[model samples]
Target: MHATVSDHRSDVAVLHLRGELDADTAGQLSAALAGLLERPVPRIVVDLTGLKFCDSVGLSAFITSKQVISARGGWLSFAGANPFLAQLMETVGLSRYFAIFPEVDDAIAAAQI
Candidate 1:
């Protein structure tokens, strides 16, 4: 998978991810998210609109990112997940842990609130 980071406003960071999020790309995702946490962004929105697939490794990366953000008193949410990915998260019992939104704007608005 490919990842891009963008600073949105002062306290929020946006991560735009594309391609398949499988084991081969999970490390990159983790590193990218870790780098984002290095700064003091109170909120992070992960945009998965371009993402095609996600595996257990990818899910773990999100979990790790969430843990890091939470430890720093920040929050992380997911946006634009396709139905398949959303189903995977639900099946894995991770939907409750993440603030999943149907749109990026909704995720951002939720974070801002």
Candidate 2:
């Protein structure tokens, strides 16, 4: 997988991910997320529009990120997940843990960083 980050407004960071997020690529996502953790409230919207697949490792990465950021009063949101992936998250009971949006702007707006 590939992770690219951009600032939205002056506070929110958008992390756009592409390809597959699995064990091999989870580290990249973690690294990208780590860069944004320096912010006081680390509001982040993960753009998943380009992401094609995600395995358990991918899920772990997100979980870890949320844990670290939540400790610092930051929040993590996900956007643009495909329908199948959205359902999968719901089925796995992860939807309640993470804020998932149909689009990036929605996540950013909801987070209101």
Error of 1 at 10 (Å): 0.8
| Every model: Cα RMSD to truth | 1.1, 1.3
True-structure lDDT of candidate 2: 0.89
lDDT of 2 by residue, 25-75 (tens): 989988898889878888888999999999988998888889988998988
> Tens digit of lDDT per residue, candidate 1, span 33-53?
878889774588999899999
What Cα-based lDDT does every candidate model obtain?
0.87, 0.89
Superposition TM-score, candidate 2 onto the true structure: 0.94
Question: Candidate 2 regions off by >4 Å?
Answer: none
Q: Report how far off residue 16 is in candidate 1 (Å).
A: 0.5
Candidate 1, residue 40: lDDT: 71
Backbone-clash count (model 2): 0
Superposed model 1: Cα runs more than 4 Å off: none
